[model samples]
Target: MGKLTRILSTAALSAAIASVSLTAAADGTTNWRMATPWSGGPWLERDAQSFATHVRELSNGSINIEVFPGGTLGSALKVTDSVKSGVAQVSHNYINYDYGKDQTTALLAGHSSGLTPEEFMLWMYKGGGAELYEQYRLDKFGVVAFPCSILGTEIFLHSNKPVRTLEDFKGLRLRTSGAWAEIASRLGASTVVLAGSEIYSALERGVIDAAEWGSPEMNRPTGFQDVAKYVVLPGIHQSGGVLECQINKKVWDGLNPQQQTVLRDAAKLSVFDSWLSSSYADLKAYEELKNGKNEIVRLDPSFIKAVYEETTKWEDEYAGKNEWFKRVLDSQRTFKKDMQSWPEYRLQIGVSEL
Candidate 1:
């Protein structure tokens, strides 16, 4: 090549490198864009913010994350891919949001009658759940993840039609997400997948007959109570679940050990914070719903019994289909069985397990 051509090529390459370098922090600090699926200030959204606060406070300004509401960086439901593809360096996600990538994600996210919120947290830290999830996250999405926050059991359904029995769900059009949608379909409900924003309009216009969102505490302000005739209790479809923080693998690899620990510790703190806040908010939300016009309907024991039975079958069937599904299901089942008698012991001694 001519000297002029070679010189021009070198200069162009240098300019491209300099422009890319400018996206990083000038002070040698690590900056991240955290995309989350939640736009409203539900506990989920606050969980993302709370995690960022913990990271900032604990990292002492070395690692800074800018929070972006859902859809700011990409499709709210697809932020895990957004992180993987480098549209964002990090994301706060509902682990099951990536169910399309790997079905076992729902097992990580939590499912019907699997574990309570408290037990799920315990299992993650104490029962080898965390290690398995890290492996799964890395393998499935090429991201590093922590269970950053959790929700208590959600309301089963907020429906204009009363859903008190197992038969009541037959032919019912339900708006839901993740594994519940699959299981609900198996139980004779025609399940429709809708984002949080689409639920209200679909419900109001009779596009869906029923919907299940978050816990009563998380649901109160959504005005579901105003439109639905009945608010179903005791979130059987999902006992409880962890919300996840997903970081790009390359970004995670770049951080020093201390910065990594800061992120881990911050994620743990977010979980603890969410537990306390959800406990309080859910109590108040339950009372607030009691005063609202909607009729509060508790799922019949028979209905719950049937759902749990089907839930087990669902797990067992998937365990046969997917290796990760089997591993996660086995771990959860083992952890849950190991704690089976604790609730009875607590009740007999006048201590509440909750």
Candidate 2:
């Protein structure tokens, strides 16, 4: 080859290599798809939207999350598998929705510990449950878990007939979510499992005599009160349940440490935001219901005690049969016992507090 031709070829090669290196360095921004089971108007949907915004702000637009609400990717039940199988890069849903995958996953939502939303947040994040979750549940699914949000104590049963006593719940066909349905069934109510969006129609059509959707404020928009005039108070089943944000393992590892930290902080903030929404909405809903002539009946203390005893039975039976679940419950119970000493009374309350 001519000397001039060789010099030109070497210069072109160097320039091409440098261009490729620059391109790689500039690939700092990451775009992820997040799937949510919540409909566009639900508080959880708002939570996801806020989380996406915070993530963008924290990462300075270097990381972008696109949310698909209404289970556009898949139903709430499919969230765990979707992220695990790489069908979605991330998912937002309650841990109880995936109880079958690993019973331990539902421990956070279970009635056993009687954790308030805030205490659950502290335990799930600062306490060792977060570590164990990452170690067990997420690792098993090839994903990572983040405590994204919470719904404080589910809305009590909105019923056609008032449920003030244990006798009233007998033969009552009530719609519930997750393991709570099982608990309700054992409590002598005929339990029907239905999604939140469907509860209104179900109640109206006599498919369910009663239901617990969420906080009263959250449920009011669902039109439950329009169909059922009775609003039962004091949620016993889901006392401020925790919801999780799950990321595909490979997608999580690809992010830079700074980007990951931003995501973690964003999710943590979302938890607080969701808790506040529930608290504010419940207070407002209570006032509205009272003024609107809706009968708000607190469950009798006797019934509450009976329900707690039954829940303990359920927990004991499951713990005895499932070793992994047993370990998680034991760990959570220990944590709860320790948290009782915390200055916050929210940490100290139990089913008795209801």
Candidate 3:
């Protein structure tokens, strides 16, 4: 689509998502409070609000969800905890936040940029990833999960210095999280851990040489470009991942069959809808940066190849230590291999063969 068309579509979707219809409570209505890690405006928050709206409509107002942006209900760090403790019946968040308890959670978020969006989507729906995700969440944290939002590829490095090559990353301090943090460390960069609010200042004060955040649209307003003039491409850290709707197990157990189905369907719908909108918006955001003061740096192909090799070694060691990691890793790798069949066949034949 053209830029103007995409812009208009994004604006319309934003406006529609801003206002969600909810009827007055009646008998049989199940009230839920959903806490999210985003304060407001970002598509992540919109994803949560959109899911709640869908649940209300699909359940015919039998389910009413109130979405609390970050810090309103609890700190971003405690979103999952809030849901588990019943302070909120549900939370919208990245599963990687629970990595302290289960390393497997990191794989679900982004395993070293392991799966591209195309492969990830196929694995999620057709390759049993949903079931594995649900099982892991319930086992690791007393909650049920449905992937409520899917992130597009993010910016790899927003830095004051050029980080286009593997050599440049050596001894460079960076701010990042999840599995990529460890991978970055092994790659000879000193990876720093910082909160979302601290990234800009960390870059401004020269505390971190670079940082990786979400998609372009999400990072634009954070003002990273003002502090760091280099915008790196192919966010190898998080090519894609899901933000989940994690429900309290007790509350989930109380849900009737139809209510449960409504929640699941709503999450699925929101994921698909958000992917389309986020992708278009992100592409538009990337295009706008073409003439900006920030210098765009593409990661060297060799750097990308090295990361793939390192990720496999790191994952293998973890798999040996953790069964869940092995299981999920196996599922993803198998699906990725299975997905290659079509491309391989197509390469061996001409279009005329069809």
Candidate 4:
């Protein structure tokens, strides 16, 4: 073949390859969706909107994702199935909502053993909890789970009456959820599981005398204070709550490596931001509630200790019955115990809290 002809043929081959690559990139970019369990609510709204915006921008407008708020696409509980069955490409839902499918999920919702928000975040992100969570999600649920947000510990009792002692909980109709309901029921509170939206009316009509929702920031909007005058401090049941964002396994596998990396990075960043921001929000809400003349009270240390002991026992019993929960909890406990002394050692050396 002539040299000129050979050069032209090579150029044509290169052009064809470039065209195929461009087509593949375009196709991959336009094919993704994320559903969130936040329906115009501030917490989920802000993060979900941020994620959708980042997804589009990072992909250079090549990738497009639509965020379907809770109930807009489906109920929060339906999200897992929606993703699994390919009805949705992705979703953000509470792990506890799926506890029926796997008890380990609810167990991970809050540490019955009392890991603070800071402790839980560190354990999940830096201390090996992520790997365990991934195993549970992938092996059991057929989903790619990411710990995207932590709404601080479920703070103390908000009620129309005071809970001065453990005995005060007896026969009290408390609105609660997840494994806490089981624990609370055992403690003699008539636990009623109600959605956040329903709490206001229930509290108003005296359907439920008390309810433990999210942190002050999360609960403030629910108008719980409007009906219940007493706000309890120092959350016990949920020292911290982990919210997960999951993508369908098949959908996740279908993405290009670059897309996968983008998602993973965004999710990790979101968690860090969410945790820090939530702390600030909660602190602000606590100040506002107290200043607004709301009756605020902290449980006595004695009561706190008693509740913690009972909660830990519940955790051990439940963990024993479920091997997966047992593994995750044992791993978390071991990791935390190994690192527990570091904070004290640093403190003794005159290390600054900052």
Q: Best-fitting candidate, measured by TM-score?
A: 1
Show the lowest summed lDDT stretch of 10 residues, model 2: 17-26
Model 1 lDDT, residue 242, Cα: 89
lDDT of 3 at 222: 90
Where is the poorest 10-residue window by lDDT in model 3?
A: 16-25
User: All models: lDDT?
Assistant: 0.85, 0.75, 0.83, 0.76
> Model 1, 1-354: lDDT tens per residue?
699999999899757644543165777666678888877686446788899889989988777788888888789889988888777888889888888778898988888965889898989999999889889999877889989898788888889899889899899999997888888898899999887888888889889999998887888888887778898877888888888898888888888899889988999999999998997888899888889688888888998888999998988998998999999899998998999988766554324765
List the candidates' TM-scores in order: 0.90, 0.84, 0.88, 0.86
In what order do the candidates fall by lDDT, top score first? 1, 3, 4, 2
Q: How much is the lDDT of residue 223 in candidate 1?
A: 88
- Of 1 and 2, the candidate ranking higher by lDDT: 1
The deviation in Å at residue 234 for candidate 2 is 0.3
* True-structure lDDT of candidate 1: 0.85
What lDDT would candidate 3 get against the real structure? Answer: 0.83
By TM-score, the candidates rank as: 1, 3, 4, 2
- Alpha-carbon shift of residue 112 in model 3 (angstroms): 1.8
lDDT of 3 by residue, 47-72 (tens): 88888899999999878888888887
Across 128-164, the per-residue lDDT of candidate 2 in tens digits comes to 7666666665545667887787777766788998898
Point out where model 1 deviates above 4 Å.
Answer: 1-26, 43-45, 347-354
For model 2, the local distance difference test gives: 0.75
